[model samples]
Target: MTIAPAASTSALSFDPADPVALTQALVRCPSVTPEEGGALALLATALAAEGYEVHRPVFSEPDTPNVENLYARIGSEGPVLIIAGHTDVVPVGDAAAWTREPFAGTIENGILYGRGACDMKGGLAAMAAAAIRYRRANPDAPGSIAFLVTGDEEGPAVNGTVKLLEWAHRRGERFDHCILGEPTNPATMSDMIKIGRRGSLTGRLTVQGTQGHVGYPHLADNPIRGMVRLLAALDATPLDTGTAHFDPSNLEVTTLDVGNPATNVIPAQAKAVFNIRFNDVWTPETLAAEIERRLREAAGNTVRYEIGFQPTNAVAFLTEPGPFVAMVADAVAAETGKRPALSTTGGTSDARFIKSYCPVVEYGVVGKTMHQIDESVAVADVLALERITHRLLASYFAAQHNA
Candidate 1:
């Protein structure tokens, strides 16, 4: 359930230096997807010391083990503002390729480096620092300010934001607006603001055939041949022309495999994996049906196949040019002297779920090094992001007060 304000939410302010330290502090924790790694506890303790009410809930499901999450709020009133992001980082694929130890949270030449440094930990620290600064500046500010953070955002995502929102809703917590600190800036922090995202769907097709000697072509059906035909059919056409708010839909064949090594034998099965990032022009149902149709036509009773699609259901969604969008644009323009493009391109994020509850927009540090080996955020950029976030909250809250 959502956490409420404590007996007495204390007025707290942190050193601007604390945010950089917090970024390193969080990167030091190995909270790789669904693992707490003391990240949540550290945040909870820090927030609690600032006199905010903190709740760390463990959410679970049938097969997935429980994951720890943190929800903290500094007020129990209206005009509620929420800053949300995930703490978990993806696995450090090849640790040996790193310039420094992945989780060491090392800082050199004014650059802080680590796994979570940019993916979100750095952005998270910036938000927390901004919040602390806002609280200190406006101790009696109207409306409550809260943070909804989860551990499962970087993993399967089944028990993450989707579940956390449900938990918070059950407690009757309504958020006026939310800022998801995803690494939205593309190049120089002037590139983009992800106002929405296209839908993503992944499917794996397994074509079945009778195994036989390579010379016995007439005696047995070859699934590899069928698989190739099916892939060709799907890859033959572009999904659609680019939409006004989204880019053109595209389908890519990620993998194709046949488990066979012999030169004279035909494999019993051939499988291929493909994914689609569709625009609003098509729904999952329509796109999925189209794929099935293409596969059936290509196979034409030559080989039997089983198709399994894993639906991420990140349907294309956009927040119209409203107050939230305008304010963020204004913040970027004011801070960086560049008005970012309101984009709906790129991969899915927790904002997809947050959009269901409130108007959400993603704004944060430059993402150039997010998932890289030596993921790092520039020291100046971190401070600049802190300022942008601070200004966003100030402007948003001010707008609410004036309204």
Candidate 2:
């Protein structure tokens, strides 16, 4: 599938220069999770200048940190397309590791350097710049587009898109589809697209026993022994054989702690933490029960243990082959001539939430440098991404209207 001709100043009316600038603008803002840091205000101003009706909502749950989010709509008709992303970034660790200032948004040797540059301030800029270009060319284009942005995607996620979706739904707002600008590609811009994601579950286990001198092995029931047995039981059993759409479910032990410093003392307690990245074979509830059952059998009634699960709604989900996935696959082929894989390999993402509201997929810049020191995106790749996004918007809407 060939894309429309290279954008001219007429078809590509928006300042091509501003996309990199917008990325730099966002990176300069220290909008860490749960902090607006003026990022939302800057985005709101940019969208409002383009005639979008924008809404900024600050939401809070009883215990979660209060969050700020934004939703903007430019038209209000059929096939409403939603472009969703987050302005918040994870904390930049050890600024000394960076070649340039983390927030400097520096451009050197044709690469943009900053915290959110790849993970996804750059993606957001591409979307915004493309929207501007599309609007300028097709001033009366059919259908409509909106942006559902959140500031809590990087935090505990208590008051972000999950709440924003409900708020928008109450106001009678609906979306036919959504595209998240998460950096999904691995080594190259056209390497892959995330059609689905594996689910994640975290659990903590605490085993209790008598505290005593190590010399008196016969009298003291060492909690460390019980912890070892329980952990081995869980690890010995495979979660499942495997699934066609997903890889084998794997569990990894994250932490094992006893806290006892004395060489002659048997600690009164032992703790182990484990996380599972599972496939569709298990849900949070079922997998959790299975874990408890294993622990019970392993201890053999000798040790008292407490298992606590901090379940996240990162349920495994897939967007079946359809127009949404097809549009991206075709766009990647058109731009790079490579047939990218429709993968479910990565850890969970915000798409886990958006999937429940509408069919969603993730595609964006190659992420070789994302979350690493001096994270950067190549200038040529960024330009290619803008072209790909612009073509997708045009083709997606064109198909929606035609259908």
Q: TM-score for all predictions?
A: 0.93, 0.94
RMSD of each: 2.8, 5.8
lDDT of 2 by residue, 109-212 (tens): 99999988998888888887788788778777888889888899888887898888888888899888888888888988889998889999999999998999
Compared with the true structure, all predictions reach lDDT values of 0.84, 0.84
Candidate 2 shows a clash count of 0
Q: Total clashes, candidate 1?
A: 0
Misplaced by over 4 Å in model 1 are 1-17
Model 2 alpha-carbon drift over 4 Å, by segment: 1-17
- Relative to the true structure, candidate 1 has a C-alpha RMSD (angstroms) of 2.8
Q: Residue 289: error of model 2 in Å?
A: 1.3
